[model samples]
Target chain A: MSTTLEPTDRTRIRRGRNRAVADRTELHALLADALVAHLGVTVGDHPVVLPTAFAVDADGPDEGGTLYVHGSVGARWLQEAGDATVCVTVTELDGLVAGRSAFHHSMNYRSAVVIGRARVVTDPAERQHALDLIVDHMIPGRSATLRPSTRKELAATAVLAVPLHEASMKARAGGPVDEPEDVAAGIWGGHLPLTRVVGAPVVDHQTPAEVAVPDDVRARALHRA
Target chain B: MSTTLEPTDRTRIRRGRNRAVADRTELHALLADALVAHLGVTVGDHPVVLPTAFAVDADGPDEGGTLYVHGSVGARWLQEAGDATVCVTVTELDGLVAGRSAFHHSMNYRSAVVIGRARVVTDPAERQHALDLIVDHMIPGRSATLRPSTRKELAATAVLAVPLHEASMKARAGGPVDEPEDVAAGIWGGHLPLTRVVGAPVVDHQTPAEVAVPDDVRARALHRA
Candidate 1:
């Protein structure tokens, strides 16, 4: 994989060009950090966007890499997305930039957009690996502790892969760019940094009293802290 | 405005219909809580999804209400979005559902998708109001403190409104629904609740020492807590 992102005609940043990041590593980092991705596909004559859990594999079988998003086989949008052109976007809100003027007030965020043709993973071995990655992406070491997916469960799920070749990332950080006049007016301006807080795990009602919270789950809570 | 969400042919939830929310109040609540919305628009032949800050007006001059998203007038997508069919989605991840088996693992989230024709706000009064709502949406009572937007600023920004007439919301909460056999096996299964944490406001370097962090900003952090 190339170290820099190769922006295609559609992936090029036309607006807010100053915020664009050419580094491919940043795209991977943003995708890894984001838990959900919004998948866009044309349904009939209109466009539809839906949120889904996503996982990325840097060395997967795709042009640059593979971005995996799974849904039920019965999902109409997912079925239509197969072999069709799609756009996947992942965004992480970092902070709220408070400027002296409302015009300058903005959000500090890292966002990536990838445009490609969706490929349904038909290979059993690769499909299984992608499923594991999706599980572990949410909670590290999670899939290993759970029972294997049954054939019926596997058949019900459908995984779609989009190549990471034509991708572009843009990010904004730090304080807002307020006008010099506003800054000179002594108005308070900065940012309120936001972070995702993972709370304590609540035991399922069906779990036996003897079963304890696993190490991986506990670690996830602590790591976020 | 009706109390229930009016799902059109495109906005109706097909897959995971169990999670679909019919209450319009729930859609309003989710839109109020979410800071970013992913907008999907078909540009040329492919669909493109991008994240933008959004605000909702419950009694705006639209069919049910109005959902507002703003961007630079120079933005190509925003320009193309006018009078075009667009999809706006807002999602909030509530928790991670850990099931006894890999097949049952899922995420608890509230997501709303609105499909409608985008109308660029032309009236100066409504456009100004939308801009203020966009600002106050980020930090409550923020626009009141900031200086009024100049004509140049107003000209540079473009606000698009999508009626809330055709919208659908889906939410999943609590623990995962594991199979009876998996639950009987005594495997630990539950959920890790996720919350958005707003950290201390970092003062801009350019701000005078006399200028203190505003009360609204401090209140925002406390409210999120």
Candidate 2:
């Protein structure tokens, strides 16, 4: 839990204005909390960002060493991006900061940026582990209840693993910081916090009514609600 | 509100799998619902994605013709990416679809992808309007209550506008779609809906207790909570 953040050549934050959190522990926590990531890959000379499901392997205390992103084998981006340097970013918008003046308005957010080369996970054992980790990452303990993947189904999926060594986290929280004059002007200034709630589970219509909802599904449904 | 999607040369979905949405109205709704965007910009030959606050100008029915992004003038990504083709993506994760088998497990999300070139907004009046649009975008009726931006504050901020003509939306919702054999296995299958809640406001400590929270703030606090 005492991991430090070492800024790499590309992971450094150049703006440095209102960047509140940059520690490795905080980065790991943010990565664990977010379920989806916006992955950036080069399409010719321009950059394209796609929202995809991602999971980080649990190796340390809230620290996932490698990030695993999966897609269909027919996905053009995955097929074209062979061992290419890419970026994976996960962001959580916690609140909206309202300042006394229009210019100072900002958001309270936690973001993690990982910059590295992604290699296709070819080994069957590691690929299986990555798939399970992804399922459990979204819903803890849900993977154990599900059936394993068939060889044909596994062949249709493509898994990519990116090392988390060159990564950085940045965050901002708390109330608005208005200028001294604006504060004295007595304009209302505060922050409206935002939280994510998991709603009740909706069972599939095709499922039989006799089957009861599993504990893992119910637990996550009520968690942070 | 019946605008169909026009597949541009750049914004077309090449992988055509599980892309449940393509209507322009749906794309506009997703863009309006999301507050933060992952902006992809190039630095030398590599792509970097940064989480930033953005606002879409409302012109048609939930159709914002231009995407406006503002940041500090000193930000490196904004500076280096002068008139470069950029992709701005906004995504909302609605649910986690858990199938009976690991292979069919997926996520329910609404994502909008815009591919275009961003130009720095230089007109003073347009820049002022863009700043106010961003403030009101985060919180409705917020800009009218706060004081206007000073000349110095306006100068420090750089606003970029990217046309939203070349854009597309993709979404997936409802329960998991499992195979027939997997459905017969009787393993649990459902979706856990994720929602965003607005928590109570936290006022600045330096502010006097007599200053009351504005109605706009209180209204949004209870909205969609």
Candidate 3:
């Protein structure tokens, strides 16, 4: 079965030039690769945006997959977002596109935007599964290495589930596209790609020396490099 | 002259645990290191967040510095954000902290949150200067090589200025803070640091071979590597 995103009224790209990646497979891959998401929700009249860890199950039963996000029970945003409409955005800065003119300079990036009303995950079983997905999303096979969340810990956390029905991913890549006149001006212009890498893991000071770095952690850190 | 941010009612972090970097000097440094910012503004009743390029003027007349953000004139968010309150957040994810238990897993990040009303920059000269600052902010000395914006181009852009007076920077560094009980379980737990690096510039295929890469571009790519 081919997984494709059905664009809704809110998902349609109003700015024609900003639409880069429209294929569902490519958009899903971009969302899966992102480690964090910026969640936006209104509190009273003002809007607050937070950088948060999130997970999306691409191969799940849901047609377009579902985005999972969690926060402290005491968080004001969390309180305001109870069954409220929200916008979750994930952006990866890929490169800097330097054009020969000041107005043409731009950045190459892959960004996904999801708009939906988040429903609080209340079922204990589903909540546990969602938590596992989040942990594994950060580090593959990480959920198996750690102990399960306690009842008290689960009660202190608030997880929101937003279906990926209204979502779109836009991307820009490759070199600078300067105008013909600017290109002939002889000013050097191109693109500098930026990459995100992982460094060596630092073990906890209190942990015993026998506790070695797990295969999952070591593999992810090395894979990024 | 010290450029320190003053915390206000809206910017003051209510959640004490989330307040990581309270010192203004350290917070200012964290903001300077970020490349992109997430802007949150209300469109009608819904909140929309956009990942955008921004510039901060630390040495300028503004006390805590001013954040300059520009967008297309046709954008709905830009049209609705005329002298309205907004939130600008810049986050740099430093590392992933894997704890011995699922509940304690967290990320090490440096984030700055600025909450205030943004004013539309109407002055032509100030707007041009802001545009240059944004270009040079992405790549140092980049604005001088590029041709200045034309009258039409200037008219097509909407620049907003938000003073950094009501802002706060919060950061979390180092390894995972696992509980003693979980640590005794012998699970491998630590933090994997993430770094952003820049790759070699790829010149446009249509450009002539004689157009060598500028010193600033070469230095930036090498420094990131």
The candidate scoring highest on TM-score is 1
Give the docking tier of candidate 3: medium
TM-score of the A chain in model 3 = 0.94
Q: Which ranges of candidate 3 are over 4 A from the true structure?
A: A59-63, B1-4, B16-18, B59-63
lDDT (tens digit, per residue) of candidate 1 on B12-82: 89988899999999999899889999999999999999999988999999998999999999998998899
Name the top lDDT candidate.
1
Per-residue CA lDDT of candidate 2, range B1-225, in tens? 237766577788867545746677787788778889999998777789999888887451123377889998998889866599999999998998878888888888888888888888888887887888888888888888876778899889998888777787788889888899888877668898999988988888867889999888888788863
Q: lDDT by residue for model 3 over A1-225, one digit each (tens)? A: 346666676666677445656688887778777898999988777888889999887654444677899988898888888789898989999998877787888888988888888888888887888899998888889898777788899999988888777787778888777778877776677888999998888888867888778888888888662
Looking at model 3 chain B, report the run of 10 residues with the lowest lDDT sum.
B15-24
Docking class of 1: high
Worst 10 residues of 1 chain A by lDDT: A216-225
Q: Per-residue alpha-carbon lDDT of model 2 for A1-225, expressed as tens digits?
A: 337666677988777535846577787788888988999988887998999888887461123378898998988778755599888889988999988888778889989888888888898988888888888888889778877788899999999888777787888889887899988877778899999988898899877888888898888887762
- Give the range where candidate 2 chain A is weakest over 10 consecutive residues by summed lDDT: A57-66
Task: Encode model 1's per-residue lDDT on A1-225: one tens digit a residue.
Answer: 999999999999998899999999889989888899999999999899999998999999999999999999999989999999999999999999888998999999999999999999999988899999999999999888887899999999999999999999999999989999988888899999998989999998888899899998888777662
Q: What are the chain B TM-scores of all models? A: 0.98, 0.94, 0.93
User: What's the ranking of the predictions by DockQ, best on top?
Assistant: 1, 2, 3
Number of colliding residue pairs in model 2: 0
**Model 3 C-alpha lDDT per residue in residues B84-105, reported as the tens digit of each score:** 8899999998999888888888
RMSD of 2: 2.5
Candidate that would win on DockQ:
1
